[model samples]
Target chain A: MKRLSILMLLTLFIMVGAVGAQDAVTVTWWMEPSGSDDHVQELIIDVFNASHDNIQIDYQPQESINDQLRPALQAGVGPDIVWLAGNAAASQYVAGGFLLPLTGYADAYGWADKLLPWAYGAGIVAGELYSIPVTYESMVLFYNKTVFEENGWEVPRTADELWSLAQQTADMGLVPFPYGNATWQPSNEHLMGIYLNNYAGPDNVYAALIGEKAWTDSEFAEATDLLREHIADLGWFGGSLEDYYSLGGNDPTAMFASGEGTMMMSGTWMFRGLGPAFEETGMEWDWAPLPPFSEDADMQVGPYSYDLALGGNLGVNAATEHPEEVGIVLDFLLSDKARILELASTTGFGEWVIPLRYEIDDFPPGTDERVLRFHSDFAETTGAGRYGYTAWTFWPARANQQLWEAIELVWAGEMSVEEYLENHAAEWAQDAADGLVLSILPRE
Target chain B: MAFKIDSRVGVTSAYRWRQILSNYIFLAPVVALNLIVIVIPSLTSVYISMTKWSGLNQPEFVGLANFERLINDPIYWKSLSHNVIWTIFFLTIPVAMGLTGAFLLSGIKRFQMVYRVAFFIPYVIASVVNTELWRTLLHPRHGIGAWLAKQGIEGFDIRVFGSKHTALYGVAFVDSWHFWGFLVIVYLAAMYQVQPDLYEVAILEGASRFQRFRHVTVPGIRPTLVFTLLMIMIWSVPAFDYIYLLTDGGPAHASEVLGTYLYNMSFFRFEVGYAAAIGVTMALITAFIVAIFVILRRRGWEI
Candidate 1:
């Protein structure tokens, strides 16, 4: 009996050792979710961990990704996965040797084929892939259909129609576009990108972006002038520029839903917010592509052109202990398209509108058709090479900064459009000389 | 017995040395922490000020270039001027308000605690909450401005925070409203420390209420007043959070301070060295102000 008891004890010890040895490698990835709940990260991380048996993920939601990233990267240590605000931000990390070169992982996973071509190329730095664009977005016009119906307003498709409608809206004592930068100062770039694309024409703006033409050209000047007229003088935005500056982000949505404003021009990211806002107000909301503000008949596909933007990117940290595990995680995130879309359908599309090939039919029952429609519109517009560039994605940091901040001066009429463009050109020139410019994807 | 006493005295000397050693031993952790977190970082920042860094790469030295750029930068000068205006406003208006409130409250014996608590509530409230409260009340369309306009009040719908002329003042006003209660509480405590007999004597001498307060109360709280001033002056160098949260130094940077400029340069533009240079300038300005106070004290000023 004693011999049997000793043998059992030995067996139990051996079993415990084996179990301890089999523990999965933990890969840490901190998420900066749009919502405080971290619901998207919770879902994705849970699914990824369950599917991958050999590797587990430790999810941490950060309050401020920028505040945390700056110190952690500087210290040669950070989470296994990195979330950057944009592809441009990822490039800064790449420059600092804080991000891993993902060329090998891309080859192994065929990431180039899996992602949209431009999305795949967005992370390339010094001819090496250092980041991956997890999400692609565009600025769009979201209008209150309830308000539109009440006013008998039709969605404008041309420069003349848009101005006439704006004028009408203004005359009715309703703000034409209740836009502001009170919450996010960089929001000015959204309008800047819209004006230059729809007015300057996507092709001309593209040429200017690639340095084929100067920004001080007549087209851009006209766009700038049009912006000044509508935004500054006409006070079409929130009754006056003063009122506009006073308004926060949610205020515009509320104003639109409550019929105070007929329309609000904002980014696709606001898709998540429109439902609850409209539902509460019992107002129907719908979106239309920002129509081309150009008079040129020669410009092909003038209407329905979108200002393409990369919302954020994912990169592997160079200091990560489990690089191999991180690669599997990256592949799971990027390649598992069906699951991602399912999650997006479950969560409702906003931050998770990734750059993967979408099977829109695969969305579950009772999905909001409005979000799905924007995706459809976006893909169709970009596919036809009728896409413009977002200043955040295309312009280098300082130049992109000037694009938003310096426009305030122009709005105040302290600086002329010509001078503003010149300043923008100078910053762009300096950024280009520093090799900080992103290699833009050529229009098809 | 004499030899034994000498031996005990020798033992006490060794014991005193041991106690001294233990005090340092107890203080070692805190001292080390301060060195690591504050002193070392401050010194490193001084070095960083001279370097061209992106906060991502190793810093490259570029002596005095950032300072030269800052000198030429109109934005920096604009921000500095706003900061000066903020300091002047804080020192004058709030100090006067605090003195007046505390003197009036000190005279009230009944519900004094209630009044103190009520006045102190705003100070204890978070800056974010205070800013939001003021923002809602001051909103051009949806707030009091709009309501007054609805009642047929002309020009009451002025956008205080949105207009360039009033943005800085608007933010400063909100910040001061939050800060005023703290000053009142502090002054009230100092006023208590003044002798009751001195006020009685002032009354007997036929001093008016204002005269009594001016002569007796002010002189008695002089040290506390000077201390508060010194703190405010020093604090002004780093004054940013309220302004940043409220206006973000916007409407073309009408409320921009040195702190916001440093933050933008460091984080947004990734011009770390330039930001460090701005930080150094702020520190130097603070040091210079402190030196003035120190000089005053050295020359036998009571404060």
Candidate 2:
């Protein structure tokens, strides 16, 4: 009689435990594959699952997140949380009522205090936070240290110095800035944004973006002319325009690593690929702030860097059944700075957007010193009010498209600078009138 | 007796009606699939073309405004002209190459199968792989152009896909290189079906090789030739992968075709309404070509 009672009680306990396990909330997360960072994301997901018993996450890595998310959201079926490319994409989803406004959760979680002010401001649409920034990026001048040393050239800090160095580099048979836009024409925006912010000054470009000034303003025209001269007449890229077009995105970095090119202008995100390319050649490379494009001290933003909102912006699907659980997952992902830094240190996944509370010296062991210094320098420069803007993160869709297309025509000499500026200005003005322009955070 | 005969006829007529209804039931799945995938999307596309939509917000009824904009858009006209040029090039070059290849292969016997497989291999390869292969081969630094320059050949280092003047032709050449082989296999099958007596008669009449090809082989393969031409005209309307992968209609809109333009407008610019109008225009062009072919057939032309 005692044995029968014990066996019955044990079976009942086993059944109750199984029922409890089945009741755990399942949250689906859609992430845009970031090459090597995908494994880091998977690791984070596993850690989260192991730490929490009430919630389970199913991670789905998508090749083209926006392309897939748009249709699925329209059909009223999508993952609980999605990774958007930037604030521009988040605004589109917010307008469509596909994203859940996270104002209350953000306040409860103290996200505003934890996140950088500019990053927090970027997620607001019509006075409500609809997304959480997961990554940050900026453009800088990348140069081959070996080549610069061999040629006895100092990194230029002013517009005049830059032009002089470019001339000397050309005389030495090395490309001053190796650029390519044939396969990926939109990459032209990287160089254009840098020049626009540096030459025209961030204030004027900001005004133009927000419709307070015209693109035909003299500052913009000056920038356009400078680009044309470099591309067409000067040929600072070491070849004809045709040769520039023939080169692919990776070709410039490869050339620079091989000591065939002196300098390259690209985003910090390129460090992932450059790290490996430089490793192969045992070549030393470093970055410098962009040279000022204006001689007037007042016009320059003190080596303004064209900072664009990049990386994944996590948002909750409005139709998700588990909103609370999804919010919890987002908080776990963004709030854990230690784990993020540790991952960044160990795996070179340094693109996380959260402002670190810990000291730079506390970075985990095995972190690449070069990568750490790069991020530290980027944080310092952007913190000093030298950050500018990028079109992909700010401009309306149509205006942004026209910006690159018009510039290509200008580069090909098919359209004059005046015509290009006027055309873009008209399109931008109309988009502004339609309330299609995204909110631009004021310069700090 | 007359009433019995009437009853039997009524029972047979009722059985025939049941058979017809069962046949329709068997075809319902295919008809439903066609309606869902083809008929519905086409009709929806036509409706979407008349509205201003960004694929995110509610589509505003703009009624023909998109078409009006397209009429004034220079890029649209440029893309359309490129497509026309593309059609003409494929009609001449690839078709001629396929015919010549088929004629030679049809003459050989020992290595016939091997040659056929070798020629068709490119057609079987994926577009991305094929494009990447050509991109490397035509690269200005390390490709054939660079090698020729290394050998002291002047003017050989020209950037083919990079130059606006040559980008369209370069993409067309790559696309043709992959496509001509399929046409060869098709033409060879049709050539084999031709009766041997006709060739014998031409040979007995003291006809030269060219004369025999013109008199016997040409007429014998007329049906396949006409069919291939029609297919080429239709396929050229949506020629996207090569040009898109190669130049993306770029280096200053030099190789802009309607297909790539439509894709850019829809996905990149979010001008779905304008893209739909372009799509509708493409459909009309295809329909017009089919109508012309039908008319020719109705007028007693063999094609």
Candidate 3:
């Protein structure tokens, strides 16, 4: 009995040893969901592992991805690849010297011509490709079809028609427009996109941001004037400013879906969050270009591009033992552009046309139809001439926060538009005083 | 007798050595923990405050520049003022309310358990959940306060946190809800131990309830009140989670306290050095207030 017991113990130890000796390559990726779906990471990992022989992709979802990434990169323990929401922070990360320059690699892979020019240029900083643009985002008008159809009103093709329709909708006792001023992106960008394109004209707005003209100029004042009119004409947002954070992108879309408002201005990424409910509403809704301010003006719509840059990239730590392997894996991941788009669609991320190898004509199952419409719109618009480039996108992350906070202050009536402009100049002067300067020329 | 004395001395010396060794063994874990968690990080923060660290890369030493910037930063000054006001407001008002609540609860004989639980519920709830609940309740349009406004209650229709003038107060009122219960519990526990004989003796001498409270109950719980007040003063200075979850120090930094301002500096702006300076200043201010309370307590004053 003792000999048999010893034999059993020896066999168990050997089995454990054999299991521990299994060889696998572990690659860590940092990702924050740019859309509503939680299954994006899981689905991608499952498929990638199934297709590969000896590789495993580990995903980490972070709340403040930037904040955590900065510290981790500083500690020389950052991930192998990072999926980012192409935004202003991506450039800042590249400037911080934490991202691997990918210009040569992107060219070698023939990815330069695959992505849109705007999307590709958005990720470049100081003549280096720090990141690959994964997705494109834009703010657009979402209106209640049932309400408009019931009123026998055509979808407004001009700014005047929109306001006139709003008045008519208000007379019918429905909230004409619903948006919040709490968040800079949802509140300011949403309003600015429409106001800048339709009222002030996108060219003048872009020039002002790049310092070709001062923000206090007459054209800028006209923009603010237009904003003020929206406030005066439109009813109060359903919730208080304190609840604005929660009401930001998703809740407001939900409000529009539930018939709380006739129209809302929100980002395209919201399609996934509102998709299921929209399917239930059985309400026929269609996308339209933002109407022109005058009859002669072109239909203006602002493109919301998530500029994936090195500022948001995951850099393999130089300190890691398997640097070559990590690079190889990252290269493989970026090589498969079709898979990236598929992963994005599954993740409920906004439509992005990756300019890399393998283009799938047919979208995978679970891809929302609204997303397809946006993708086509992106192809038509190319986001040039109509939309003002994101000022936050080209600047450092710190500067962006300051700008947003200043915008919030102005919106809260703490400062006048004039004071806001003055503060903007002072803030820039302070940045100069602190030895930070504009690093890139503004897009023409 | 001399041999016996020698043997006793030998035994006592051996015992003394063992006792010292055992005491060190018991204290080793705690001392190591303090060194690893608190002392090392605090020292690092102080060191980092003297540098130009942006939560990334090597921190370059730029002595006193961060501190100078903090001194000139208007937002920092405003946040400091808010912190000070919050401390003073909590120390004076919440303590009194707590005392009043405790005194009232002491009179109830039946349903006392239910009352205690009711009063303690807010204290036990997570601060974030409580802040969210109060934010909803205090919302202008679709909240309880607004519902009251629809029923003809004046001043309740307006958003409690909408204006700069009332934003901080709205946050303060929400915070007061969670804090008052803790104060009540502490005051009650202290009041329960007050001598029954003193109250009876005061009553027999024809003292009214108010007089009895002023002389007996107040004197008996004075020490507990002072301790709680000092602790509350320290806590109010760094009170962050409630404000962060609710206001985000918005409407033009009207509701900003030092903690939120510091957080924005570091996490939002990536200005770690400036944030650390703010943190050090907060620590100093907390220490100074605590020292003042200690000094006043030593003077046996009832403030």
Best-performing candidate as measured by TM-score: 2
Worst lDDT window (10 residues) for model 2 chain A? A345-354
Candidate 1 residues lying further than 4 Å off, grouped into runs, are A1-22, A36-38, A298-301, B1-31
What local lDDT score does residue A226 receive in model 3, on the 0 to 100 scale? Answer: 64
Estimated TM-score for each candidate: 0.94, 0.95, 0.84
B36-139: candidate 2 lDDT, tens digit per residue = 99999999999999998888878889999999999998889999999999999999999999999998899889989999999999999999899999999999
Clash list (residue pairs), candidate 3: A86-A306, A86-A307, A86-A308, A90-A311, A90-A312, A93-A311, A114-A355, A115-A355, A137-A304, A138-A304
Residue B15 in candidate 2 has what lDDT? 85
lDDT per residue for candidate 2 within A261-337, as digits (tens), equals 77887777766667778888888888887877888777677755546556668899999999889889888877777
Q: For candidate 3, lDDT tens digit of each residue in B1-303?
A: 555988999989999999999999999999999999988988898988999876654588999999998878788898988988888778877777888888888878998778788988998899878977876776554678769878888676655565667777778888888888788888899989999999999999999988887899989998898788778878887889877776678667888999988888887666788789888888888889878977886898775
Candidate 2, residue A283: lDDT: 86
For the predicted complex of model 3, DockQ is 0.35
Every candidate's TM-score, chain A alone: 0.94, 0.92, 0.78
Cα lDDT for residue B219, model 3? 91
